[model samples]
Structure formats: structure tokens, C-alpha cells
Target: MINQNKKTYFKERISSKKYGVLMKKIIIVAIFCFFIISKFTPIHGQQEKIPVLMYHHLENNLNSNVVISPENFEDQIRTLKEEGYNSISSQQLYDFLNYNIKLPENPVLITFYDGYLSNYELAYPILKKYGMHAEIFVITSRILEKNEKNSYLNEIPKMNWNQLRAMQDFITIQSHTWDSHYKLVSNNGVKNAALYGPGYINNNFEEQLQYEERVKNDLILSRKLIKEKLGYEPIAISYPFGIKSEDTIELSKVAGFKMGYVIENKKIIKGDNLFSLSRITVNGNETGDELIKRLKS
Candidate 1:
């Protein structure tokens, strides 16, 4: 009886040790798989974000807060390429925001406001050289039939319709506004963006109906003109001076825009407001490296 009991104890102990070893191996394998899967696969329900860059004039000698030099612009684009960023189109961005479509690795957006001729003369070529695409928002009233042949020293020239058509392959044109880029002072002499409303016009405060009428008309006209000239309606509009109100957002939808961009100085993430999306302004003074650092942040 004593011999039999000893055998039983020894067998139970060995079995316990073997089970422990198996559990440890299983746990280690699970941890390794978790690491590999997290690194290699896109996890569902994780927040995905992309940077949208807003650029203005590209000038040779004029490097202001908004006017980037051609050399620096090229550097920025080159750095973006090296960093594995792909410039997604405006429509792609919309689909990603709405449909949860998988975006390319490290997707970014390049956009220009005010539709300066330098966009065609300078930025367009650089973008084409890099095989990148961009969007330009034009003020409809400022677009002329032909280039003014003017100098950036006096007044930075606006892009002509011909120039706009020429760059259509690389540059997508959208609406800035018709004629609402200026400020409208209220009866109390407090000035604000024209889209802000309650403006002092015709020696009287603009009624709510009147303000709505003016803004809707301007946006509709902008959309209509782009469709007429470019053969397609624009789906997006960047507010003048990045100014917009709740009313403006609803008005934008009424104006037939699918998306509206604002200057919030941040990247846009999934589940954000489709209207009032954020854009990071690329500072002209910053080097390409600095710009990359900012983007990483």
C-alpha cells in the first residue's frame, strides 16, 4: 500500500509541472501574436486621423507667414515623400470620413486658398514633378478670363480661368467665396467676418433674413460658376479667413457642399464634424524639417 501511494504522488506532481510548462508557452505565444497583429494590421474601431495642409501663395522672393518660397515648398514636398505620406484627393478624404474607407498609409492633404496665379506658375509644377495633387479654392469674382501679366510686387495676381483649366490635371479647384472675404462692421462698430452676420450694410443692421440671403447667394454663385467653367461642381469650400458659424455650416450644406474646411491648426480624425474640418497651416517661415516635426506632433 505504501509503495502504491508513493507512485501516485510522484505521477501527480509530474503532471502538475507539465501543465505549468504548457500554460507558460501558451501565454508567451499569445503575447507574441498580439504584438505582431497590432503592429501589422489595422485594428477596427481605432481612431484614424490624417493631416490636411493649407497653403497659400508660393512666391520666389516673398516669404511671408503664408507665402512659401518655391525652394521651401519643394523641400516640404520632398520631405513628405520621404516620410511616406501620400497626398489624398478631396473626394478620398470625404469618403474616408463618411464611409470608414481604409486610407493609404500616412495620408495627407495639400490645399491652397485664394487661387493665386503662383499656384499655377510655381506650385503646380513642383507638385507635378513629385507626382502629388492639391486643391485650390478660388474666389469666383476674382477669376479673370486671362492672366493680368502683373507682378507679385504690386498685387499678387489672381489665377486666370485659362491657367486654372491648364492645371486641372494636378490641381482641383474649389470655392473660397464669391465676394465675402472682407469684414462687415456691425451697428456697434464691432467688425467681424462678413459671414458672421448682423452686419452694418446700407446704413442699417443686416437682418437675419438678409444675411442668410446674401451668404447663400454668394456660395451658390461660387458653386455655379465652378460647375460652368470647370465642367463639374465643387464638393468643398474653405471659408474665407477660416471664419464660419453654425448658420454657415447649415448654409454650406444648403449650398450643395459635401465638406467645409476651417483653420483650426489641428489634424482631422474619424468621427469629427464633417463640416468645420480642421487644417494645419504650413508656415512659410518654417523649414521642411520643422514642418515635419510639427506634423509628427
Candidate 2:
């Protein structure tokens, strides 16, 4: 009777040991599958953000201080194309931020400020040649009236209504300001450069309100003009001469601008201060190699 009981106990122990080994194998396989699925799934940490480059003027006249030579502009675009860099519009960027739409690899944004006629004349062709899109920030008040060529300060004739409307099909148009005013002031004397800069200001207030009622009015007027002329309101804006204060940013937000661009010299990174977004300045002095280096850095 003792021998029989020993055999039965030994058998039961052997069966339990086999079941344990099988359970261990099953757990290992499940863990391996989980890792494989996670590896193939999309993760937010792996995404990249591209830089937005800002340009002012593109022209053949090298003597012009703010102008970039057409040849250099062409070279820059050609190099970008050769390097497989994809250029996108400001709206596309806005969409990417608002939604999780995946932009093309090596995406870039090219923007021009001041809406100089040279942009429409020279830069437009080059951008079109490369099949790339760009954004142009226009000063609504500076936009030359129909058949009116004479303007103050040799303002370099702005794009006319027809030109602006035509370009709207290819490039995104945004507001710079109604006028190139810096701050809002009441008295004309205070608005003068001797008191303040070449921008507007209100003498009623001692502290400069960068985003005063006057500034908001200008933005509203600019939006109206853009809508009437281009059939759409601008979603972005470039600070005139890259000038802004904390109040100015708030005013811009109130004016319904989704993105505000600045001319600072730095690489714009994720979680960067939105008001002071950095841009690479492209001018006649910068070579293609230098531009590439700046972008890479």
C-alpha cells in the first residue's frame, strides 16, 4: 500500500511540472508579439519639425540693400530641389499643427515679407519653376492703387490688385499691417519719428501700447482688404520690421492671426516661444552654401 501511494504522488508532481513549463512558453510568446506590434506602430516621439525660412526681396539689382540677387535666389531654389526638400504653404503648416497630418519628409516653408513688386516679378517665377509655394505678407495700405505709380519714400511700387489676385492662386497672402506703423498714438506729433519711430502712436497714453486700438483697427482693415481683393482672410501675419512687444502678440491673437512670424536669427524648435519665432534671413549677401549651412544648423 505504501509503494502504490508513492507512485501516484510522483506522477501528480510530474504533471504539474509540465503544465508550468507550458505556461512559461505561452507568456514568452505573448510578450514577444507585443514588442513587435509596438515597434511597427507610429509614435509621436519619432516625428520631425521643419524650419521656416523668411525672405524680404529678390531682385537683380545688387545695389539695393534689402534685395537678393535673382541668380542667388535661383541657386537657392535649385539646391533645395536637388536636396529633395519639399516646400509647403502656411495653411498646410497650420493644418499640420491643428491636425496630425503628416507632412512630407524634409518639409520647409519659404515666406516673403513687405510684398515688394520684385517678389511678384522675380521671385514668383523662380518659385514656380521649382514647383514650390511661398507666403507673402502684404501691407494693405502700401498696396499701390490702380494706375497710381507715385508714392512717398520710393516705396518700390507694390503689387497691384490684378497682380495680387493672380499670385493668390499660387502663393499664400497674409497681412503685414495696413501701414508700417510700430505703435498706436493719438497725436500726429508723437507719431512722428522725432518722438517715436516711423510708426503710429497715441499721445493719450504715456506707456506705449504696441497693440492699441489703432493697431487692431489696422489689422481689421487689412483683413477686410485681403478678403475683398483675394476672396479670403489671412491666417498668418509677419510683424512689420520684425518689431513686437508682449502686448503686440496679444493684439495679434485678438485680431485672429493663427501664426505670427518674426525675423529673429535662430532655429525655431518645438515648444518655442510662438511670438518670437526665428527665421533665416535671405539677402544678396548670403550664398547658397551659407544658406544650406544655416538650415542644417
Candidate 3:
């Protein structure tokens, strides 16, 4: 009888120990899973940074140095598609900056400047073919004043209100500047500035202030016109001729633009000022391989 009792007690103790061991293993696995999930879960309110690409004319007739041929453009788009790059809108960029939107793994923002009519005729079809969207920065004054008699691309017409409205459904319409790109001369002695927009030749502090004020007024009018035409205020602006100044950034912010774009070879990343985002220029001179190399490097 004594042996039987001892055996029963030992068996119960062994069972209890085994159960405790199993429970401990289960707890460890649960804790590890929790850790992994926490690591992968999206953060609630962190801004994401990504690169924005700038492009101009898409034609073979323009200066080969500054225009991207249609075939090369198609090739570039195909490469991006094959590589799984997701092209998003400017609003998406703003959301990523303001809210913690989880952008795709390889995200890019494609933009076209000058409101070229070719953008509507040629680039639009190609973009739609690739299931991509782009942002177009229009010179509001030009759009408002463009007449039917003016020749665009020697064939296609400049985007009228109907076409512009249709584009707004797929692309985000942003402001470039009002009367800012006819002839621009920066105070830094850049020669092409005069050809891009208004020249800033004055060196006096008061004169500089006046020049800045004039620019601000023009930009303000641009914002109003964009709002009137598009029914929403634009939050982004590209400096005319990619010319930037400290005063220009401040004025842009005051004019209600949250971000600004510049033409540079660098890709945008975190810790960059929102008002001075860098862009990669796409011109006709670059082949698909060269463009890829430039972007990758």
C-alpha cells in the first residue's frame, strides 16, 4: 500500500511539471509572435519620403539635348513597370508627408512641366497605357491666354478646358508660376534666368524685397487662377527654370504651397526640406540605359 501511494504521488508531480513546461513554451512562442507583429505593423503617424522625377517635352523634333523621344519614353515606362515601380499622385506625396500613408515598396512621383500640349497628346496615352499617373505644373497665365491659332508641337493643340478637366481626373494639376517662365534672371548671374522669367538685376536690399514681392504677387494670382479652374488649391509648386532662393521658399509657403520642386540630380530622401525637394530631369538626350544608370546611381 505504501509503495502504491508513493507511485501515485510521483506520477501526479511529474504530470504537473510536464504541463508547466508546455505552458512555458507556449508563452514564449506567443511573446515572440507579438514581437514580430509589432515590428512589421505600420506606424500610425510617420511621414514617408520618396523620390520625385521631373520631365519636360516628349518629342523627337525638339532639341535632342532637352527633349525625350517618344520611343525612349515608352521604354522608360516599360522598365519602371517591369521593375514594379508604383507611380502615384502629388496628393499621395502630400499624404505621405502629412499622414503615415504606407507607400509601395518602390514609389516614384512623375511630373511634367511647362504644360506642353504634347503632354496631353503624346504623354497622356503612354502614361495611361502603363497605368501610371503624373503631375502637370501649368503656367496659369498661359493656359488662360492660349489661343487656338497658336501651334503646339506643330500639330496637337494646347490643352483646352475640356482636356484639362479630363486630365484632372487622372493627373494632379499643380501651379508652375504665373508669368514666371518667359524670361528669368536670377541674382546669381545665371544667364538663362533671363530667358526663363523676370530678371532680378537689382542688388539693393529694398530692391530685392520689391522683386520678391512681385514674384509673390504673381504666384498668388497663379494660385487663384488654378483654384478657379481646377476647383481646388494646389499644394505644390515648381520654381520657374528651377531657380530657387530663400525668399522664394518663404513666399511659396505663404502662398499656400506645402512643397516645392527643384531640378537636381539627387533623389529625395528623409531629412530634406519640403520646400527644396530635388528632382531628376528627363531629357531627350538620355537613352533608357543612361536614365536607369542615372537613377540607380
Candidate 4:
């Protein structure tokens, strides 16, 4: 028992230490994003709870954990409609957060990360039939150019820019990162500097300059290409994998993203931290009623 207790304590100590460092690394990005947003969209002084539901794929191959069946997805949307949950955009949230604008009685924002092919084909039609719109954070590099080999592991390939354009009538397409959607792994550790988790990207992890340079390039590259291709500036960035920290949060500001979204398995609300916003990731099998129940609980 004593030995087990010691092991648990040491494990927690190491975990806490790593978490602390990660939080510290986030400080610069957090403050930077805060400064930019404060100028126009100040944080709301009042509390307003809003749920931002996240979906990845509208297909089912049972290969990835993020897949949600088209039927299930439609059911969820229907449930939201039946429940009187009005969908809102990140811009609306931002305005509400900053300007204290009046929002609908029950505002829920539906967001899809990793622009999947099914989004344009399956999800778009369903959302349209329901007269609902959503926010799609796209991966610029994955947006298939003509004749490009779709070797990415999306199961169903990502939607092309043309298809995305057609969906723009009801969908608010945004940036998920140009080339930062993938992961970087090393024997020492792994870093998702696209929107980093904790560790530095440098070999020694001491070269802060190199880290910021890579971060800047990655962030700016996505926004630049997105603006050039999509013909409109992307207002928000949904961090790839919903992974972001203070560093990435501030980088979104430098990279030209006004709002940032991260996954924290909680409902977002007005007066919520803008840069470090949380979201509830919908599982593949959980039906709409189940999601509603989870929200209530």
C-alpha cells in the first residue's frame, strides 16, 4: 500500500509539472490574443451559457473515432430544432462576448473541424433542409487541388474548394490550418505546434526563437492561403484536434484569426474566455437525445 501510494504521488507530480509548463508556454499567446480582442471584442462581463457542438465526419467506415453517421447527425440537428436550440456563429459569439449584444434565447453553435468531403455532400444538404448553418474550419493543404492524390487518412477525402464555395451560402468556412493539421512525433516527445500541446518544437527545446518562427510561418501560411483561395478573411481558427495553448492562441492573432476554438469537453457561454474557448466533441454513436441529456446533466 505504501509503495502504491508513492507511485501514484510521483505520477501525479510529474503530470502536474508537465501541465504547469504547458500552461506557462501558453501565457504569451493568451495575452497576445487577449490584447487584440480587447481592442474590439472585449470579454463579456455577464455569464451566458452556450454549447458549441463539434463534429468531424458525416460518414461511417468505423475506422476513426470521430465519425458520426449521417442519420445520427441529422437526428441531432432535428433534436436541436425540436428543442428550440438556435444555432449561432463564432462571430455572433465574439460579438456577444465583446459587445454584449443580445443573442437568441438558446444559442448553440455547430462546428465541424477537418473539412471532410462528407461535409459538402452529406452534411450540407441535411443542414440546408433544416435551414441550419454551421462553421467549418478547413485544412488548407487538404483542400484537394485538381488531380492531387488523396492519400491523407481522412477515410473519406476532404472537400475541395469549389464544393466549399457552394456551401458558403449557409456555412461559414474558416481556417483549420494550411499544413498544421497533422502531428509531429519524436522519440523524446511529440508536438502539435500547428496548435501546440506542451513541448517545444526545437531539437533541444531551448531555442525559443526557432519555435516562434515555425509557429508564425505555420499560422500565417494558412490564413494567407485561405484568404487567397476563399476570397474572404477567415475570422476564426478551430485548432486542429482542438489542441491549442497560450502560444497558439496569440499566434492566431498574428496569423490573422480573430477567434479561436479549442476542445475542453464543456459547453461554451458568453463571458467565456475567448481565446481558450471550450467545446463538446460529439461521439460517433451518441444520438441527439443522448447529447441533449448530457448537456442537461
Top-scoring candidate (TM-score) = 1
Residue-pair clashes per prediction, in order, are 0, 7, 8, 2
* lDDT of candidates 1 onward, in order: 0.87, 0.73, 0.74, 0.78
Clashing pairs in 4: 26-246, 29-246
Give the Å shift of residue 30 in candidate 3: 12
Prediction 3 TM-score vs. true: 0.75
Error of 3 at 216 (Å): 1.5
Candidate 4, 149-220: lDDT as tens digits:
587664468777778778877898888887777666433565454456334445445355665677678778
Model 4, position 28, has a per-residue lDDT of 79
Ranking of candidates on lDDT, top first: 1, 4, 3, 2
TM-scores of all predicted structures: 0.83, 0.76, 0.75, 0.76
The global Cα lDDT (0 to 1) of model 2 is 0.73
Candidate 1 residues 208-288, lDDT tens each?
Answer: 999999999999999999998889999998988898899989888999999999889998987788888998989888877
Error of 1 at 134 (Å): 0.3
Model 1 residue 49 CA deviation (Å) reads 1.6
Error of 1 at 208 (Å): 0.7
lDDT of 2 at 15: 94
**Stretches of candidate 2 exceeding 4 Å from the true structure:** 1-47, 61-65, 182-211
Candidate 3 pairs with clashing backbones: 67-284, 68-284, 183-197, 184-193, 184-194, 184-196, 184-197, 185-193
Encode model 3's per-residue lDDT on 1-297: one tens digit a residue: 999999999999999999999999999999999898766564674434466878777776553645677787888877877777789877777666657465777788988887777788888888889888899888776673444644334533446555677776568889888777745445565555321333554543236556667778878888898788778888899988787777788888888888998877677665577888888777666666676667666
**Candidate 2: residue 259 lDDT (0-100):** 76
